[model samples]
Target: MRIALIYPPPWKIAAREETVSYGHDGPPPGHRPQDLDADFYQTPYGLFTLGAEALRAGHRVKVLNLSAYAWSRVEEVIAGLDADVFGMSCWTANRRGVALTARCIREHHPKAHIVVGGPHATPLATEMLEHHPEIDTVSLGESDATFLELLGRLELGKPTSGIAGTVYREGDAIRKGPERRAIHDLDTLASPHTYFDTHIVMTSRGCPWACTFCGAETTWGRGFRGHSVRYVLDALERVLARLPVKMLQIKDDTFTTNKKRVLELCHGIRERGLQFFWSCDTRVDLLTEPLLREMRLAGCQRLSLGVESGSQAILDAIDKKITPDEILESTEMAKRVGIKVRYYMMLGNRGETRHTFQETLDFLDRARPHEYIFSCLSIYPGTRDFHDAEAAGFVDREVFFTETFQELKTPFDASEEDTHRMNEWFFANSGLRIVHRDGVADYRAILERLGDYHAAHMDLGAALYHAGDLEGAEHHVRRALELGYPLPGLVHNHLACIAHARGDLDGMMNHFSHAAKVDPQHFVLIQNVNAARAWFKQGGPGRKLPLQLTVRHDFQLLERTVQPTLPGPLPEDWKAWNAIALPAEPSATYLRTPDVEGSQHVLKTRTRLKVVV
Candidate 1:
């Protein structure tokens, strides 16, 4: 039977009931989904997993990531693909959007069975099926085997409610079926990489640690089960042979949780002589110098560490089980071996206070990771923190069910307003962003949220320019300069590129000079810098002042004295170096010997110029 797997648009949440407002042009007020690169959405790995399994079982499967597509386009796309089953994977935030999508698919393909699964649906299996009439089934826990079996039974036109780890609607009542055992041998699962963009290789399933704020352990259980070394290598080989993916992210809760396995994987990769730049995340306490070194040799480009907080009390409170010293050592080891470190930090966790925040800042000052993303502590369903928060009357499951991701609120000493302000301050002071989708908000929010901050506006401007919005690009870039966006040099460099594009030599030279004064390190800026320096020696470009120079060719002037400079403002040190060309076949030639200044710039060419200015 034909199956359609969907990664819903940004707006949907799995628990989205019949009565919530989500189909508006924008996301719900005070709510934004944490997308990782909004411009290009990652393939929903869960959908890929289920789809791959379904495909392998001799069932036809079609998958779509509707995150990047506009909400209106969703219906148009879904209507075209006819399938027997419509399956969607959603996060808690996208619960409303998933329900909306389900409604759309239902309207078009009413005969198709709708199955919703993911972190959001897995927890509230009964609640989701009951609340959302559009939903036919909610897959709970591990769905790879469960879904495969469910689809087979459905193809045979049988009842689905009795399927393990699944909740389905029957006779106006929501009922859950038998619990399916977690797949102990993860290698039996098909490689989802062949189906979608990201080769999100989950080397292992389940996290042993019971971090209070995280809901991972709840969903996958506490036992850490990993695919064998050969299984992993074989999976990678399959993906590489079938597709052209240069990078593979080994998405394990803690990649190095099994040190011997990691070493073996690294060694296996090297033995096969297969190389690809990859990344993985792990706990700070799990890292060691030797293991990291092996990973580096195996072409690990980035290492993401969860240095959630600096306060020992807060760390212990959250059951992080990682010390500040361990964080530093791990960061140092990763950096020393040339693996760029990315930190995942959470603020406003248990025992969080202004003092703890400052402690985190201090720790960051010492650790100095390459990059980091921050998040306010999230209390998702099935987490210890969630249960405690609920018990304390801080949050209700009904509200959580209705609002989904937006319902999560961090219970910190600081007020919501204060936490938000602190988050911005943390970004400005500590120089770290959050783990959010690098989408339109990510670029526009800097100015809209922070009120004209400079650093990334240039980036936004460039992005706008590339998107054919020349006016918007120019405005943002100009605003960036006005707000003293830390990298003013880039502003001048950008202006130089525009000037160069418009064939304005003086404009290009003037901006290039300003950029060079500010130390042009970026490639384009460096090009303009070098060009400006070469075009004029003492007086910079844009200087309308013309030097009367004569290129005397055997006492005869061979060139014009008046050289036209392009229109725009000139630099302070603009100069015109005039010279006569003297080739090897020429009867007369003039050459300058080395001067006191150790600039050994030889003017060797097809012909050299003799200066008579």
Candidate 2:
């Protein structure tokens, strides 16, 4: 049987530009004040893995990432792959795009078994097939085995009624099955990297901790199932031989859940002499100083902690099963071991309020993470939070998934105005702290800038300053200036932020002066703008805090240019794309990394950098 797996583009910007405009009142459900969640898109490793499974089952499979392609062009791309089955991955953010692509594919091949899988499809399986007649069936969870089984039955012209872990309509009635039994021996399966030179490695099948906001259980089933240390080592060796990637992100739910396995994996890396800087995400309570030190010695350059909120009450409310103290101490441990820490922060959960926001800010000041990744609380199907919200009448599944994101159900405990204020103030002050003390952030931005990335670096710089890494933040902000940023006043404003944070009144005023000289629209130059921005940083509502101003990339051609650049798919010779040094453009988002001056911070990053869902 022939199969084709396609991952659709993430955005509908061309079709919904007018409807997607930013709101001045409050940030949307998907956006943080720092950047739109759409800024990054990664390879659909799930579909690729399924393709690998199909290959092992003696079925032909083709994998394609049409993420950057316009939705209208999906039909054009699908024609290239004439297969008996078409599998598409779905996510809430890209559900509409998936539907559009599915309809086009259906138009071209009416008889093909068009199946949808992934976060969005796994929970809303029956509803998805019901709401959109184009989709033939929705695969429930752990589809590697199910998809392979599906193809064999189809080849034999058999009914799919026997298949477990799938939902489909049968004579006006919907049939649903429990998720497929979890794959115990993960090593038995072929790594997706073999089919596509991917950078993500999932050494585990499920998560042990059930966070209220996460949908891991809905898709992967309950409990943790990690691959043997030898299995992970074998997979790592395979990737090392295939791609020239320097860093491999271990895409696991709480990679440190099994400390014994992690230790063995680190030992395996040393024994094998596989050289690469790797990172993984895990809960704060799972890490120990000794474990972190061992990890660093084994070439783990970074550790990402899901420090979702700073407020202890909020943490308890979300069932994060972690304390604020654990978060701080974990950062200290990772820092002691020379592993840069990246904190994944979320605001506007069940218990969030002005008081909780203040607690979050206070925690940020104390923990001093090397970076802060900000996000707003978002609802997904099948998560505990989603069910609670539905039962409470906060959202209606009838239109929630099919229609435009409803901002009225936004989960923040504070009023819309207060939420807006929190976002703006946190972004501004966070930059001053991160830059002044913590250190530089991950070089992901530096690698991205070598392509079509075009965010204002001052935004990042400001974030860094607030996290307490002033020099690193300044390095980037100045790089932004060197790249001829369209708004220099923002740069001046940020420099002033750094100065003001460190008690340099003269230096603070100096930057503010430069900001005013260049553009009178500087936050510090505008009446009350500086006051509002500094209010959180200085802890006051009406008191004059301090001098404040606010704000807040290039590309190159290669020999045989790669079109629709990074964060998108490669045409061919993708391995070569990963192995070469990238040229820089003056207008691209510039970032300073530990790499030598004038060198691109290359990771041979996956077309989409890998992160756990």
Candidate 3:
């Protein structure tokens, strides 16, 4: 059987003047805020899982990420592709794209089986089928097993209507199958990491907590389930080897739900000599000093906590059973072990008010985490917030289909005045915030807890250099290399800075040259190297200029030169599809989507850097 999986764009996008070529060597240039505000570019991880399953069953699978492609290009690609089963991963932001792509596929391949499954499609399966005649089936919830079964039945020319965990059209009426039980033994499923090269990895499914703003429970059922420690370790080993950068985001709903499992996994990482910096998201209440210490030793770089709001009343209203104190204590603990603490703050929840809004800002000041990001409450289809809104007549199921917003980013039950104030604040104060930086003492404490760790040595060295202890900094930086720090370019970059401080012009350039050759892909390293090149181009040390250096263990890598590729047949019109030229200028309705309100920010970004497709 021939299977095609697609990740659609958020909306119909007109091509821009400048061309941004996709490459397989690395991701396109880092996302500029205005051009790529939402995370729509990332191909949904589920598609890889489904593709892996199909491949194991001896079926050919082709996966394409058309998330940022222009509408014309998308149409061209869709028209060129032929498959028996066409699967798409839908989300609230990309619902419009899913429909558009489905229609394209239906027109191109009249007999192809179009299946849509995702958070958005799962909750509104019946509506999706009723409104969009192009989609043949909607797989609800965790769909690995459901998808494979559907494929088998389709291959044998059997009816797909009776498959569990699916809703399909039958004689002009939509019929839903029986509820599918969640997979108890996750190890039974093939690991997507074995076949795909993606920085995103989810070792667990479902969050035990029923936060009203979250739709996780709806997506993965009520309780939490995780792959066994060994399974996760094996997956990690495989994924890390394939990734260009050893940094990964373990995008679980609640990564540390089972503290014991995480601890054992952390220990296994060190024992197996798996050296990589990684980040995970979890609740504050789930973290502990010991677990954090072990995690840092095993190369845990950052811990992101979902601290939605600071007001206890607001927290209770949203059913977030955690206190502000817990958030603070967890921040301190993670910071103590040299793990960067990032808080995911939210605005305009159930009981949000001007006072409560101020409380959140005050709490941020008090907590002083390493980083924080704020987002407005978006009422999705399967969340309690959505149900409550529907009941109160604030919104209906049709809004998701009709409205053009990337997400319904609005205040839940807040006064018009309060909503106005919150919107004003949010517009001014959105995006990531680096609130704090670890000092020498902080990194020293980390070294104490995690003895002889390469990352710790490098971190301490950077801190020392920043604190103007050049000699002490040099020693630790050299020790990091001796301990086999994975990113030696960072080490040499630091050495270059130290050389500059000591008036060794030749040594500084030598070190800089080495950093550029070895680690030219990292964004920070690229910036610094460019600065050095410009400096030398202008004049030598005789110019008497103070060279500014970016001295930090920024764990970010360069974006992929191209999108992820799978082992499958190329599109029939691959050459023509790649040759399609973008319009020199956008049309009047280019930014018609509500998510993209204005073109000013986008224009600003475009003039500065090439937009990554």
The alpha-carbon RMSD values of the candidates against the true structure, listed in the order shown, are: 21.8, 13.9, 7.7
Ranking by lDDT: 3, 2, 1
Best first by TM-score, ranked: 3, 2, 1
Question: What digit string (tens of lDDT, one per residue) describes model 3 on residues 1-613?
Answer: 8788898877676568635443321122333335344345667888988888888887777677787777778888788776788999999878988998899899999999999999999999999999899999999999999999999999999989888999999988999999999999999888888777778899999999999999998789999999999999999999988766678888899999999999999999989988788889999999899999998888788888999898999989999999999988899899888898888888878888889999999988999998777777778999999898788776678867755555666677677777778767776767677799888888898788778888888999988998999999999999999987877777888898898888887898898788778765455565677787788788855788767778767654334433443112234444332221111121222212222321111111112222122
Better of 2 and 3 by lDDT: 3
- The ten-residue window of minimal lDDT in model 3 covers 598-607
Question: What TM-score does prediction 1 earn?
Answer: 0.68
Please list the C-alpha lDDT of all candidates, in the order they appear: 0.64, 0.64, 0.79
Task: Tell me the spans in candidate 3 whose CA falls farther than 4 Å from its real position.
Answer: 18-38, 516-519, 540-542, 565-613
Clashes of each: 23, 36, 8
Error of 1 at 283 (Å): 0.6
The 10-residue segment of model 2 with minimum total lDDT is 553-562
What does the lDDT read for residue 79 in candidate 1?
78
| TM agreement with the true structure for every prediction | 0.68, 0.70, 0.89
The candidate, 2 or 3, that scores higher on TM-score is 3
What's the C-alpha lDDT at position 153 in model 1?
A: 82
